[model samples]
Target: MHCYIVEYRAYAREHLDGRWPTYSRLVSLGKAIAPAGPVELWVLQSGARPGSDYTLLASKMTSTPIDAFDVLPVECPRDNVRETPPIDILITRYCSMNSKAELIALARRMVKRRPLGRLEFVGPAE
Candidate 1:
């Protein structure tokens, strides 16, 4: 099945209600964009790297669309916070792949370009 990686940053891990804003947004966007495919959302925290220091906030499959609320356990303020950092969202799509090397290469290319608020497609390696 096709997979989409939705990358974004977050200042606060969780909202006042203990729900992850990024995860919520990811599921919403995924349903809107690729309602029939698997969607993975990655959230990068402050002072964190792209591929390494990121959290798999949430993911949804075509079959289990209702179970997309899965999120990492993160602590946050109970009261309203101020001066939160801005987060940029980027979406990258990977077609069916046969090997792990192709996935690694495509991820490297994505890290280099860091496309923002756009869709990128990486077909299977030839």
Candidate 2:
């Protein structure tokens, strides 16, 4: 299975509903650029670091820690049939903090994994 690391910045504005289309586009890009393999989405919050962000986000979204999410240890017999890890494409939208360098560095660390571009942020109210 192939994994892609995506830089995400959550924000209060930006509608926050268009993420699905954006995610789909990135996945399509990956499929076109990379080999035909399973992809999984790994989202790292703007404030969270690389090693732990996946776990944190997963926990908040699924109520399960990253470590516990590992199927190898769970010993689920149906693991083989599970859908190809949903193209680990990171979809981070509305980040107000973090410099470009930090985001770039994080994106580079996972060169093997695809790095979808950062999500745009809507500025403060006028």
* Candidate lDDT (C-alpha), each: 0.33, 0.28
Q: What would the TM-scores of all predictions be?
A: 0.20, 0.17
Q: How well is each residue in 1-126 modelled by candidate 2, as lDDT tens digits?
A: 324343333464455544432111121111111122332323333223332322211111233432321111112123222343444584333222144444333333343343333332344325
Query: What is the C-alpha RMSD, rounded to one decimal, of candidate 1?
Result: 17.8
lDDT of 2: 0.28
Flag clash pairs in model 2. 8-92, 39-86, 39-87, 39-88, 40-87, 40-88, 41-88, 41-89
| Most TM-score-accurate candidate | 1
Give the worst 10-residue stretch by lDDT in candidate 1.
24-33
Off by over 4 Å in 1: 1-94, 115-126
TM-score of 1: 0.20
Candidate 1 lDDT, 4-121, residue by residue in tens: 3333345442433443323212222222112334345434332323323332243444464343333333322233123334555543322332344443333333333322333223
